[model samples]
Target chain A: DAGVTQSPTHLIKTRGQQVTLRCSPKSGHDTVSWYQQALGQGPQFIFQYYEEEERQRGNFPDRFSGHQFPNYSSELNVNALLLGDSALYLCASSLATGQGWFLGEQFFGPGTRLTVL
Target chain B: AQRVTQPEKLLSVFKGAPVELKCNYSYSGSPELFWYVQYSRQRLQLLLRHISRESIKGFTADLNKGETSFHLKKPFAQEEDSAMYYCALSPLGSGGSNYKLTFGKGTLLTVNP
Candidate 1:
């Protein structure tokens, strides 16, 4: 089975611009989560989606938003990107809810490397 | 607030040496613990979870609820084992909150010949 897949392997944006990153959940998976990973740092949760609705969100600001499609694919949108947004955006997928067997077994993608200029 | 802690940013040791990576977490509820590993140019993958009590690639992590710790250990380090390790805790849902995982800063391990 294909693991989580993310688009545009790399992205570049300017300050004040908006960016959208895409992710396709693994086959048979219905949950998707977004994370931001800075260099040399672990990933920070952004939000989680299930049943085509955002079921949970991290401590991120309103500038960061996401959408979950019926197919379990996801999109992460960041408005008014800042220079600090220059980091890797990771997309993970699992087969169940946050309390399921894969609670901590999030399957990650190669990640979309975002660089905010 | 739930938090995960990885004390070492970097660790280096010769091949065949025993390796240990320390992790601590802070959460009032019964949190689930996990260890994830990322090798060079590879996606982050789950190394193991606390509930399973199983070892992967010779690595094992035991969760100690009393001490709020889960340390990853391997009897012998292999050069291929070099990678970044992250400790994470999934805080149990309570009231109206959905569960979410908080990861530590991560520790990079280097296994040399």
Candidate 2:
């Protein structure tokens, strides 16, 4: 398995523009999560998707949205991007198992570097 | 609100010396803590999780619930061990959708030769 894979390793956008990042989960994985890591900071949870539905969401604004396809691939779409939106966007995938202790064990991708001007 | 804090932004130590990366958390309920590491030009990966009670690459972290800390430590540091380390926490059970992780800012460890 290639673990998790993200598209467009780098991106550039200006204010009010939109962007969409894609992610393909690891083989047999059923859940996908997105995170944003700003400069000099750790990854912050953006949202999580399971069964093609958003299962959990973080404190991000409404401008940030996501979708999960039947194949477990996911897309993160940002509308009206702001300068602060510049950061590394990460996608993580894991099995949605009933095992609570291991649920958060996610495998991350290389991450897409988004630069907003 | 849940939060993880890594007290040091950067830590430097010589080879064969001991090193410790401090982490403290603030969460109301039982949390699953984990240590993640990122090497240069590599993706972030899990080093260890509290529940497993295992060590990776000679690094071990003991979760102190009383102090709400999961500090990663190593007795003998090596140049290969130099990387950015992060401490993360997840709520034990939140309707089976608690996979979200709260992470610390991270500590950049530099093991000098």
DockQ of each: 0.49, 0.56
Compared with the true structure, what per-residue lDDT tens digits does model 2 show for residues A1-117? 889999999999999999999999999898899999999999999999988999889999999999999999999999999999999999999987765423546999999999999
Instruction: Score candidate 1 by lDDT.
Output: 0.87
- Per-residue lDDT, model 1, residue B49, is 84
Which runs of model 2 end up more than 4 angstroms from their true locations? A99-104, B94-97
Which ten contiguous residues of candidate 2 chain B have the minimum total lDDT? Answer: B91-100
For every candidate, C-alpha RMSD to the true structure in Å: 2.6, 1.7
In candidate 2, what fraction of native interface contacts survive? 0.60
DockQ of 1: 0.49
Off by more than 4 A, model 1: A97-104, B93-99
TM-score of each model, paired residue for residue: 0.93, 0.96
The prediction achieving the highest DockQ against the true structure is: 2
Interface RMSD of 2: 3.7
| TM of chain B, each | 0.92, 0.95
Candidate 1 docks at the CAPRI level of medium
